[model samples]
Target chain A: MSSATLEIVEPGLLTTVQDAGRYGYQRFGVPVSGAIDVFALKAANILAGNAQDAAGLEMTVVGPRVRFLADTWIALTGADLGPLLDDRPIPMWESVAVPAGAILSFDGARDGVFGYLAVTGGIDVPVVMGSRSTYVKGAIGGHLGRALMASDSLPTMERDGHPDPTNNRLPDHLGAPRYGNTHEIRVVLGPQDAAFTAEAVQTLLGSEYSVSIQSDRMGYRLEGPVIQHRSGPDLISDGTPLGAVQVPGDGQPIILLSDRGTTGGYAKIATVISSDIGTLGQAMPVDTIRFATVSVEEAHAILREREQVLRDIEKAVRGAAAEAVSIRIDGDAFEAVDDSGRLVSAPAVEGRVESEATRHARVTVDGRTFEFDVEVQRAD
Target chain B: MREDLRFLPAGDQAVVVELGDTIDPQTNRRVHGLMDAIEREEVPGVFDLVPTYRSILVYYDPMLTSLPELQARVSELYRDLEDHAVATPRTVEIPTLYGGEYGPDLEFVAEHAGLTPQEVIDIHSGTDYLVYMMGFSPGFPYLGGLSERLATPRLDTPRLEIPAGSVGIAESQTGVYPVASPGGWRLVGRSPVRMFDAEAEPPSRLAAGDYVRFVPIASETEYLKLQESAVKGIHAGDAAQ
Candidate 1:
């Protein structure tokens, strides 16, 4: 058998292999570089039947064109990049099985700045300092510590079991986050809010800030009303956390992200909540952002709610796999499955089936009944 | 708990413990001391600790440990930090080649300090500087104890790219750039040593609570030989006397 691989035909702008993050080395000034949209990355991995922290490809603005070297399960999430599989539009937020030699391409992003592509068993990359994330500035981790280029052949891990294709889609009712040109981001005020005047805090909460063109994985610099400071902008350099909204002497606020320096001197007025960081990550250069302050307790509560939603998604996908069956309608076979109360049908060859001697058969899925005219054939 | 210690929440995952407002050696020692205490205790959910000039940022997983729980544990540790002994400082000697193309801003720095270029080198290499923190970029040390006489302002226009190992001075602070980056610091000399190597056992050459001593080399031929050896993985710091 041939080894599973993904050959890059055209590398997109700023495509990099990223996992959870590089942890435990911030003391030596190592940035924890990872996927900017953690939520989407996790969701993509889950849909592909990989671990939540598995390594995947993070594409910015434009996405890469690649060909699979072997038959494998894959998932696309994060942004609506107008992805096409073998010249056909594929559904987002679902597991898709691509045959060997199938080409996947994108026609630029319609909404959001970042998009994620995940494969079963995850991308095979050497884990450096406990992570596969790329820190391009320090030339550490990922594929040669830089963005992907054309002609790079990436290998995939060998997973233990097959992913159930029937119930692997995100239902419409449990809708994914929709990216737009405007975002209302929530933050927790201060490790250094005291350095700024009360009015400056008001300005941060009240005014609209446009995402500057200078934004990248390191930070999103905002151009908006001047956030006044009571004192100087300099602080004795301290550890900079992910989502730190730092305001410099220029009065511009830069929300630091995955690839920000481990420590910085600028005073941080607030930090975006964990649940909303992925939402901010999807904001484009010209997108307008408004800030809202939440208490630390409230932020944690929101995080818990987000975690519960993920759990619900996991249960919905995995729970329905047991009842998956193949149905034949008028001599044509279809994989009948429940996608969290949504009906899904796909062409399949295996599964327990119910065939009717009469012209119509009643099929029950997730407590809902549907009558279909079919030729009765028992595969068991 | 000490009256000076302030534990401020840095979002849901981290807490910044400020030891003092000033950037003095005493305060820095206490900062490292608290970090050492936390590390020795092996506190659950605490994943990373970043020690700076006068504070240590403690990063923890909120799912495993709540902010209030971490704060209570850290407060108790801060109260007993004095009992934790900070490791003895290591003085790493850096071999540097001074003047000419290597130090483009040397003449200007000397003119501003009212001294000859050689005098500037002498003053810079004479003192044993303290490494207060490693920040801004990977393995980039913020060294203190620059001579007041040699203190020079940053260049009017920042350089597009300062070569790695370039020793620079900005105001009262002096340090070496570990990687090539755009900077406005006044260059005095260039070191042959690699300040940071991701593949190395310890990525950063200098850590907080360490000392740096610059050793001047007279010949460019020796500098090239040292640079060559450094590329072959023979670090000059290990060979320093």
Candidate 2:
């Protein structure tokens, strides 16, 4: 089996390989580094016929310009970075097949802060501590434990025949997270909320907070209403979960993310719900965020709902692969015949099949019917 | 079960089991004790257990276990925590080179503490400090048991980058920076020990509930030799105990 290589032409602003996350080591002060917008990364992986946790390139603000060394399928998701294939605009959140030497580039972020690009077999980086996610602070995991640079070559794992790329996309209306300048982020009042004044809690939930300029992958420092603490902003340092809204002595809340320190000393008044963290991942500096309260049960329900959306996307991609049969004879359209020699209308099938086939072929009929013999005959 | 133990929700996936309010040895022991019990029980869906000063944050998957269920399980584990002994804490000796270039802020800290540089060094290295928790950065221990005589205020203006292994003091706290980062702590010495190695098993050299002792060396030559050995992948903590 031949492995493909992805060569970087330009490193853009910041791009690194990430996956689900590095876990089970937070106890030792290791941050669970992964793609910030997990939903987008998972969706990109699903569209590219890879596992949800497959390592992929996570681009921030701007995206890297890369050239594929071999023919492969890829999907772009998350922030709209104006991705282009060989100088032509390509669709986002959908799988696209690229021939060998095809160049993929981006024109900076148009909608959000982070974007994800997932390929067929995922980025073939050595898994460090059971994950390929990059923890830049520790200088561990991913491609050399750092962001991608120009002239760097990334290996791609070898896989069996590719999944049918057509119709493998997440529709925008189907619970896909939306990115904008202002977002309403939901939070659950935290383990340290009692340390803050009641007015501070109201201040967090009532006012708008803008992402500070000092924000990075570690966390977003927000500037907004001062969340006054009852006594002081210090606490017996405790474990900081992902999306922990910790306020320092200055009373400014910092929403910790994937690369956050495992433990922190500030009093965290609330924690952003897991379902809404992806939205924070897409927020740019100065982007305003209004906080809303949610019960833990409600947060779990939201997470389940988001998970169900992913499941639906996976089902749709698989269903499309099973139901559609793209039959192309020298780029000419041909009518497909069923097992009983009946002309069956194929609505799901799209794109040209790059194969020479004249013999027997099995295809799904009406989404429920079993294998039907598809006779690929010339229209002439 | 301790009457002060409070189970607080940290988002939807984690619970902060507060054993007590203060950062004392007894409270920290309970934190680790409960963590050990929970780990031994192998409760389903529990992924990571972080023992801090007086709390253990239990990270779990909401899909496999709900907050109430996890809280209940942890409560049960806490009830029986006193029956099981917490693991014996290890004392990792960190060899240090104090004063001069290795410790740029030594004179300042000495002046702040109203003691000579040697006296500050002697007091700082004399005690076996308890590793209360690891935080801020990887393998960076939050040590307790600092001598009040050696206590000094943090630098009013934090240095942009404090080199890794720089031993520093601030107010009532004293610890070493495991990595190069901007910090306000007043540096008194530098260690030749590598506190964190990402590629090594149990990456952090020190863990919560452990003890750390600073052994001061006389010369820069000795410091360089130890630093070279550390670079060669020799585990300093392994041999120094």
**What lDDT tens digits, residue by residue, belong to model 2 across residues B1-241?**
4565698889988888888888788788777778888889888679888889988888887866788888888888777776347777788888889988888889998887789998988898899999988877777888999998787888889999999999988998989998899999888889987888887777888888888999999899999988988885536448644
The DockQ-based CAPRI class assigned to model 1 is acceptable
TM-score of chain B of each: 0.91, 0.93
lDDT tens string, model 2, A110-205? 899889999988899888888999998788899998988998988888654555556687755674556989999999998789999999999999
Q: What's the TM-score of every candidate structure?
A: 0.85, 0.85
Please report, in order, the local distance difference test score of every candidate based on alpha carbons: 0.83, 0.83
Candidate 2 chain A weakest ten by summed lDDT: A362-371
Q: Which ten contiguous residues of candidate 1 chain A have the minimum total lDDT?
A: A361-370
Candidate whose DockQ is highest: 2
Q: Encode model 1's per-residue lDDT on B112-178: one tens digit a residue.
A: 9999999999999999998888878888888889999888888889999999999999998899999
Q: Calculate DockQ per candidate and list them.
A: 0.47, 0.53
